[model samples]
Target: MSQLTHRVGVALWGIPLLVIVVLIGGGLFALFLAVVCCLAANEFYRLSESSGAAVSIGIVCAGLLPLVMHFRPDWSLYFLALGILVIALTLPSHRLENLLGRFSSAAGGIVYPSLLLSFLVLIRDGAWEKHYYGGMVLIYILTAIWICDTAAYFGGRAFGKRKLAPVVSPNKTWEGAIFGIIGALFWAVIAGQVLKPVLTVPQCVIGALIVGTVGQLGDLAESALKRSAGVKDTGNILGPHGGVLDRFDSLAAVAPVFFFYFKALGMV
Candidate 1:
């Protein structure tokens, strides 16, 4: 009935299913991520359309190309190059500005929703290779991000004074952002204690900092995109929460950061 009600209802069903998919960690998870990225890419294209830069709908298939890189992450460059070439070829326009606009939008769609989200698959698959706690790592990341966001929202509502990014997201405040970071650290400490097989307390704290800061920036980046496009919410697919891109913006931003962190530590 209410927006909060819708949010909770979706999470109630969605979280469990997400846990299952991440834990499964293979083709099933890859297929699931492919669908989400495609939908998010479609919404991003719609946003670009609203900004007067229309990309070819056919290029939405470019979302699937990233999952192809799940097994061979090095192929990302090739896939991106091919996507750019295809976009340049497919989107024919008379004005040079129009062509550039379309090309930029198409390329952005490939990177944001497609290439960025693919790291989630890589995170799960790579981590799963070494330990059973791999899925738990993903779950920890998601949970920390969610907690950070939730704390930010509520904390902002209660004690928000200074604007964090008034131009992009007017409601967000520095107070809320600090609260978000604290929430993330809180969860990381708890997870570190339990996920001893994969992470140390120090690693978890570092992860909290990365996910907290990067993930919030991702949210702001998405908000900036929506603002520039002159719209609220990328799409209404997620009811009160907006769309797939709206929901997963933070995760998309954090996935690569965490993935690389694990890689650097020789964990994934």
Candidate 2:
């Protein structure tokens, strides 16, 4: 099959199941996120390695330690994350030379994948369960982001005339962004209606805009990384769609933002 066919097939087959499993909310949901975190971290490590940063496979396990400690919020996962930070920073500056440069690369590894991705872990462990309402928020954030992406594609094709951030994602445009936010708001409304007892329309619209904007920013952030890496995409795992990181770029960064917003509203 062509790459386009491959891409469409994967999205069609995977997104529904993934969404349903996530909406169900339980050990299965947490486990699924853990797996996603693992894959994203590995992809980040791979990109870092290709960009001339050295990292051990053990770091993946080390990265997961924060999630484990998240069960006990009283204890600072920061300390464990900091420990990993120190070790990674201290990684023999002489191993591949450019001591300071290596240190910077190592730092990005921790920030982008490990620390940022851990917020979902915190959400799962937090006492957000008023009938698993937090799960609804999480689901909405992801769904809104996905809608943004989908809307961007069709909107760009149909009406895009100005670049939104050409340096980051050229195919994305102001027109597409407008459509994305609209699409995000549409889905957010649906989600709110579906979980009517849990969220109000105003809350749903605001949350969708917040997540959609943040998710788009996250996508741009990942794009910056890919630009730095001198690649067209993150990997080829999804054929024309790129790799796991490419697919989940916004999801990773948006998770933490959603956590923060929910906290401010006392939703999670």
How do the residues 119-166 of candidate 1 rate in per-residue lDDT, one tens digit apiece?
877777774446447788989998999899999999999999999999
Q: Which residue pairs collide in model 1, if any?
A: none
- What are the Cα lDDT values of the candidates? 0.82, 0.70
* Residue range 76-102, candidate 2, lDDT tens digits: 456555655665655675374665666
Show where candidate 2 strays beyond 4 Å: 24-27, 50-54, 61-66, 93-96, 129-131
Best-performing candidate as measured by lDDT: 1
lDDT of 2 at 76: 48
Best by TM-score: 1
Off by over 4 Å in 1: 50-59, 72-74, 93-97, 127-131
Tell me the TM-score of each prediction against the true structure.
0.92, 0.85
**lDDT for 164 (candidate 1):** 99
